[model samples]
Target chain A: MADQKEEVKLLGIWASPFSRRIEMALKLKGIPYDYVEEILEHKSPLLLALNPIHKKVPVLVHNGKTVVESQVILEYIDETWKHNPILPQDPYERSKARFFAKLVDEQIIGVGFGAMAKADEKGREVLAEQTRELLMYLEKELVGKDFFGGKSVGFLDLVAGSMIPFCLERGWEGLGLEVVTEEKFPEYMRWVKNLEKVEFVKDCIPPREKHVEHMNYMVERIRSS
Target chain B: MADQKEEVKLLGIWASPFSRRIEMALKLKGIPYDYVEEILEHKSPLLLALNPIHKKVPVLVHNGKTVVESQVILEYIDETWKHNPILPQDPYERSKARFFAKLVDEQIIGVGFGAMAKADEKGREVLAEQTRELLMYLEKELVGKDFFGGKSVGFLDLVAGSMIPFCLERGWEGLGLEVVTEEKFPEYMRWVKNLEKVEFVKDCIPPREKHVEHMNYMVERIRSS
Candidate 1:
């Protein structure tokens, strides 16, 4: 256990919200870990070996054992560390938090990427509709609460908040869609602003232009094709 | 707590894999609760009141408090109960399990439903391709393991396996596609067979004819539209 504490390392990409999820979780838990930024385009042998199935970022290596996937990593961090608990101790609340987190990951993240990569008007419309539906759900469910779980930041906030700036930079701003406007989604806007103040999150997020350029390139590719 | 446990009840639709995910988790945890099957086509007033946003099936009520979403309900059940734990204690393993489970839920389930709801060549091809990808990842990651977490049927297995019969019925037989052939996905097939044999699962899962009929109707509607 003593040796385990000293060997925590995170393999991630600079601009990835998924990677930031693990990063924020570790920071929130006050665990010290070595951060390794992987060049996702180049594909590192170590990254491939660590996450053969997905070969994606945000792989946590502890005592030589590796765990991939950001949502999974958040849970692992909460379970591994007892202090500064990110997940609620009560089962029902924990479930609600996780389910909301999964909703963000599955519906919001999935549809956001789909919208970014889509070229056709119909495809874009489908993605937009899905995104709107998600936003509406969030607006209704998360109203009057500072975080999804209320008061202090918890797992859902960490996962959902980490993606906001990136999604705004990439999906919403890049596509010129007013999916999450201040007028329509005041609560989400408040939540996003609150998340930006967190120290680790401020430090770990990628430069806004990088995400914009990347998304612009994708949109251009879709248009040309 | 005892009074709270007594008031717990599950509002579910029998054919839904999502509902089954909750049922299986509760059964595994040895929790005693009343189960009410909701008719989804004409959603009961109770169901609508419990889950106004999605108005979806598999809503769990504990002491008159409702928790919607099957994955959310599963986590709630696991946390509420002490015996027969479904999720791993270690953070890393839990994350890996969750990531895979989410992948299954979002990708596999999404594609599976798509396959069922369309009769066109493009739809079938997309479904086949996605199913193959999901099975490939599962086979590679879950090789030699009895369940996703090695020996016991944890959260991953419950979430992933909940959809097997639906896939086999709609994906394999109804679509006339060999999505999980014996040679291509031997391990997945074996796992599905093993999961089906569980006593609670066997009792809870609806007969194949019902799912096939619903899927065929969906396909007709999609094609006509």
Candidate 2:
């Protein structure tokens, strides 16, 4: 347990998978933190001050020290809290976990956003094709494992699970395409199914209807722009 | 020391700062390894087999286990060797180190590439301006610290030192514009000068003339295209 006097707070937008990644990590470790949801359109001064470099959400303040970047924050959480270890203990295994986490961030989340943001069908198709091609890497990674973390949710799972099965689930709908399906990504889908069963995993995920509504709202703006 | 029986090999291109980052980490840890210079245009079959995901260089093969990605490889080296520590032992300080390292990669390395790849003057100007704005963050970061790691060349130094001072030093000349300078980035330049005196860092950096020739060749191809 953390010192009772330690102050833990998270500044994040409710709909962001990035924010949810931190929430999941904090929840998984049972670290108590005060949540401050930022308005994306008009970010709070505190958020900007805390993360002036990016000025984006998902900033973790532990005893007044701020850590930005979702992956960096995840590592911070793992290192700060010892129980319910998110990352592997072995160095080699930790490297593998970090590699996949990076792959998911770049290929899945980054490209997945590109796939969603394209206002044109041709543009969306090209990116969706690229996203699918990238999905194969993740699928191959999951060939024999129940989760990216195996057995239970680990660092990669928190990174991948938060984005793919959560954000991309609604995002694919915005593109009028099913980016991830059992037929194409059986192992990935199986991993998603396994994540869905985890109670805390389910808890951290935003409500589907509200999420879909918010995603659609953003997609509409992108389409109009 | 790593087991004497273990085979350590690094597949890397001589001109690559990414590869050099790995090399510097290994040298700092005093780990002995055979280096295989990879032809980037026609990557070795062994390289492909080892890192099929990216099929890129700086692939570390330690006793048959392959670790790709420079940052991941650095962590692996630090953890596996447990000597001449690169990353800080404290989690918070480590997080700060990681944040700056990431800024260097994205803003300096990635954007610097984009700036260099722009064939047209306007395109280069726009990107150069963006890159400069980003460098201010690094300038602020180096306010009170001698190195990003503070004092000795640590993890962030290995990352930033490998790329900015080494790769970008000659790269600025290719564009006939200096992206980083003593006036604009006083502390960063001081850090660069400090790194220049570090014998191991100097050892990892490719000879200037060769790096310039290779960079110019690539730039010429980019311009013609």
True contacts kept of each: 0.88, 0.88
lDDT of 1 by residue, B41-124 (tens): 799998888887679988888877678877777777776765777888766667777778877876777776676566677878
* Cα-based TM-score, every candidate: 0.83, 0.95
Query: Candidate 1, residue A56: CA error in Å?
Result: 2.2
Q: Give one digit per residue, the lDDT tens place, for model 2 in B47-145.
A: 999998899989999988999999999999998999789999999999988988888876677678778888888888788888889878777878888
The model with the greatest lDDT is 2
DockQ of 1: 0.61
For model 1, the stretches where C-alpha displacement exceeds 4 angstroms are A1-5, A110-133, A136-146, A149-151, A169-186, A209-214, A221-225, B1-5, B111-133, B136-146, B149-152, B181-186, B209-211, B218-225
- Clash count, predicted structure 2: 0
- Kindly give the stretch of ten consecutive residues in candidate 1 chain A with the minimal lDDT sum: A163-172
Local distance difference test values of all predictions, in order: 0.75, 0.86
Q: What is candidate 2's CAPRI-style docking category based on DockQ? A: high
lDDT of 1 at B136: 88
For residues A88-154, what per-residue lDDT tens digits would candidate 2 score against the true structure? 8998899999998988887777778788888778888888888999888889988999987878899
| DockQ score for candidate 2 | 0.88
